[model samples]
Target: MRRKYNPYALPPWLKKSRDVLHQFAIPFCIFQGIRTILFPTAFDVLFLIALVLITVALKIELL
Candidate 1:
């Protein structure tokens, strides 16, 4: 059986960092999206996709 996830079990420092990343995810995604639009490189497109996925995961508490 799989164990239940417990956010409270995370260390204080890790929790703080997670909070910080959670807060920044959206802006980072937006910036990356704009950068991708301007440049349209393969790497930029891939990176923007990854950023969007990460932002979604963070919002849904899956990360």
Candidate 2:
């Protein structure tokens, strides 16, 4: 059987860090998106994709 997940079980510092990253994920994705649009490089594209996936995961509380 799988154990239930609990955010409150995380340490204070770790919880804070997760909150900070959760807040910043969107802006980071936006910036990377614009950068990728302007430069159109392979690395930029890949990075933007990764950022978008991470942002989605964070928004959905799956990360």
TM-score, cand. 1 vs. native:
0.92
Query: Best by lDDT, which number?
Result: 1
TM-score, one value per model: 0.92, 0.88
Compose the digit string of candidate 2's lDDT tens values, residues 1-63.
998888888899988998999999999989988888888999999998898898888888886
lDDT of 1 by residue, 1-63 (tens): 999988899999989999999999999989988888888999998998898898898899987
Clashing pairs in 1: none
Tell me the deviation in Å of residue 37 in model 1. Answer: 0.6
5: Cα error in model 1, Å? 0.8
Which regions of candidate 1 are displaced past 4 Å? none
C-alpha RMSD values across all candidates: 0.8, 1.1
What is the lDDT, from 0 to 100, of the residue 10 in candidate 1?
94
